[model samples]
Target: MDRRVYGAEPSERDPGPKPGRAYVELVGGPLDGMLLDVTGWPPQEVVDGAVLMSEHGAFGPGGRSGYEPAEAVAGAGGVGRFVWRGDVP
Candidate 1:
C-alpha cells in the first residue's frame, strides 16, 4: 500500500465573489431523502462550515438552528448548489 502525505496549510487561491444563498442536495439516497435548505451566506462558506460544524456537533440536538448533523448530511450527501429554479422546496 502506498502512503499519501497531506498538507495542513491553507491555499492562496481566491474564492471569488460571494452569493446570496447556498443551496445543496444529496447525490444519492435510499428511497426518501430530505432536502437541505441553507441560506444567508455564500456557497463555499456554507459548504465548508456545514462539514466542520457537523463534525463538532453543531448540528446536534438543540443546535443553533435546530438541525441535526446526521439529518443534514444525509439529505445533502456531500454538499452542492442547485442548478434550476423550483428545485428546492
Candidate 2:
C-alpha cells in the first residue's frame, strides 16, 4: 500500500491506518465539534479533509484530499447529511 502521506500542500504526514467507519471531530478551529462521517476511509484522510475544509472551504477546489476510498458515499442510494463549519481568515 502507498503510505506516503501528504497534506496542506504536498507536505508529508503520518496519521497511520484508520479503517472502517467513524466520526472525526474538529477541535479549536473554525469548525469545532463538527463530526465528519468517514466511511471506509483512513483517519489521515478524515483529518486532512477537515483541515482542507477549515483552510479553503466552500465553493472552491480543496487540494490534496488524502486517502479517499473507491466507493462514493453522500447522496447515493441512501440518505446523507452535509454540514459546514469554518471561519473567514
Maximum-lDDT candidate: 2
Question: What TM-score does prediction 2 earn?
Answer: 0.30
Cα lDDT computed for each candidate against the true fold: 0.30, 0.36
Indicate the residue-level lDDT of 9 in model 1.
19
**What TM-score should be assigned to candidate 1?**
0.24
- What pairs collide in candidate 1? none
How do the residues 13-34 of candidate 2 rate in per-residue lDDT, one tens digit apiece?
A: 6333234435443333334333
Off by over 4 Å in 1: 1-22, 28-32, 47-49, 52-89
Off by over 4 Å in 2: 1-21, 43-50, 55-89
lDDT per residue (tens digit) for residues 12-86 in model 1: 242222244233532222101223445445534443433211211324532222222332332333444322111
Global CA lDDT of candidate 1, please?
Answer: 0.30
